[model samples]
Target: MTRQRKTDAPRAPESPGGWDVRSEELVAEAAVSGAETAAGSGAVSGTEAPAVSGAGAGSRPTRRGAGDPVKALMHRHRELCERAVDPLEIAAGLEAHGVTDRTAARFRHRDVFALAEEMYARVPRGEEERGASMAPPSRRSPDLPAGWALFALLPGVACGLTVVGLELGGGRARFAVGLGGLLAVSVALRVALRFGPLRSPHQAAPATRAWVCFLLAYALLGDELLRAAVAGGPDEPWAPSLTAALGLSLAVAPGVWCARLFAVAARKRLALSKGLTEFSASVRPLLLGVVALYLCALWALLLAAGAVQGEPAPAGAGALGALLLLSALLSSYGFTRAPLLTLGAAGAVEAGSVASVFAARLPGCDWIAVPVEEAVQAWGPGAVPVIACGAAAAALLLHAARVLSRASAHADETP
Candidate 1:
């Protein structure tokens, strides 16, 4: 004769809540069955066969005292029928499982369908906390207030501009005037913003505020120097002073901005990665190189200018050097990406250089004789060397442009 097997009965709800009661009953049954199985297995020897030979018979529902299967099923049907079901109520029920008040509030703000979907996602198919083991310990500092930043920036801008002005003016009356004017303007603007109804003080770092202010001042100075350089009138003693101011401004301004920008970008990226070693490794070298190159170029220009005239060659020389350095920096940026500002500045520099050369040459009418006479008048016996320097600078600029173009093309070819 064939042996018959028994199976565990399906759960029948016998409470006010249909699925809730069923789920609880199933959980209790599973726990009780697991305990019985453990006890039975322990009582037998390792090699002994189990006495029970039914399918899920030992795993039968635990709430047998409540009712028979048919009666329990009817109770479940009655409980479900008693409720006035709605989508929102359903979502709220599910969300009550493990969600926090804040999360529930956010869900409630959404439409019914969205709330339902969110609830469904939250309940089942939930993922374990992953990527947590990979994250590094955070080392974030509290953010400084906007007011603190504004205070710090005010002093830095003032000091930087004062130093630049003093250096440019060379202790002359004109330098004092220019420096005072710049300081007054800066102070007035800051004061107005601070005390006036439009009290929106800039929230940048001190260095950043200084650089921005200096850049503005330097731009004005650059225009003046450029005009002086191209003017047909006799060279004014103050022309060199104006040029120097412009040079100093350009030299420090962009570098300050770059440092600030890079620092902010790195901080954001690091936060996203939780200061992971791999991310730091990737960004460190590039940032270091940019800062090193910029500082080195600035120092080299200063040293070279000092050597040429034996006493710093006036502010004009420094200004010119700054222009050259700025051009190179801008060109590099343009080649690597798309710096429209840099490109425009380069075009202007090139155009200005060409225009100056033509203007100088046009008056002479004869290239050889004209240059000779102009050289004699401009620098006395020393004019020849100055002329040669100008020629060399022009040549160097042209060569740089060609190299930059090739490099850009190569970069474009890269995937």
Candidate 2:
């Protein structure tokens, strides 16, 4: 009945986006009322007012999958393999792609193995002729001068001089000669290590190897002189006793030096089997020639000195010379096989030799001591030390040979 009179239908306020103006006005009024309530509540609680958004609308966007670093690296690795790129070039590429040096270093071997396997698998059996195209460029090391091998003989000169000093000279002269010889050998070794034999990967620098051998010879001579000087001159009651103990203790010094030299040489040749073989082969003959020359020269120098000084040579001097010659030969053989281990073994032998000398000179051990003492006296005051040194050297050489042979066999077995 209230609508009985024909009235126009109620019309809603229109907006361009199909929203109504009346509804918008109501919503704005409600929002304003809520904001006022919130402000009042904050004031009562002494709290800061909440931040309001300045935007009329807002939206949140999620990140999409662009790439995986590791996957990208694998792809790059495959590409490099297909192209047969140099490993150095590939490494540069990896560095540019955000792979840090630390990461590359940590994964170096693994990455190399992976790359190698990838390259190996890429080779086609059908295209055998094309293999040459993929081969790494051949590189040859420059040929060094032939005279480089002779450089090792410089230390031999020191050895020869030291032998002359020990056998032909008086006590004070012997001591001075030994000290000078030791110093000379030391200097020669330092020079060889820095700029001579160790300068090459092949150990073909005969000069350095020769120097090492010469150093050994000089040490032997020096040890003899040191012991002889300590034992021969003074007649004090404590002199013999003190000499015996000192001789035994000091004997190990030369052995230790020998071991250190051998160890250093071995470390230098650690990964170079071919070079080691070539070096050892070339040096063995040179060493033999040098050793023989050294011995003959030692005897000649001694005879010449005795004649010059008008002094008779020590009793059994010629007979005992054989012991030294034999010892030198044995030692040379020992140093060839496995230098470090041989040297260590030689040290043990030297220690035993000193003990033997001590036991030989021990009072009340007549039966055991007498024969040993007689032999030692024939060799010269400190000559007994050389017996043990020689034995140690020979043993070490034999052991080294066995080890090297085994290593070669193992290498042959490996793929």
Clashes of each: 1, 3
The whole-model C-alpha lDDT of candidate 2 against the native structure comes to: 0.37
Question: After superposing candidate 1, which stretches have Cα over 4 Å from the reference?
Answer: 1-148, 155-220, 239-415
For 89-123, candidate 1 gives per-residue lDDT tens digits of 33323233332233333323233234333333222
What's the lDDT for residue 34 in model 2? Answer: 43
lDDT of every predicted structure (CA atoms): 0.37, 0.37
Tens digits of lDDT, candidate 2, 244-320: 21221222223223323433333223223222234344434433444344445445544554454454432223222
Clashing pairs in 2: 151-207, 152-207, 334-397
Task: Please state the error at residue 122 of candidate 1 in Å.
Answer: 6.4
User: With candidate 1 superimposed using the best TM-score fit, by how many Å does residue 338's alpha carbon deviate from the native?
Assistant: 5.0
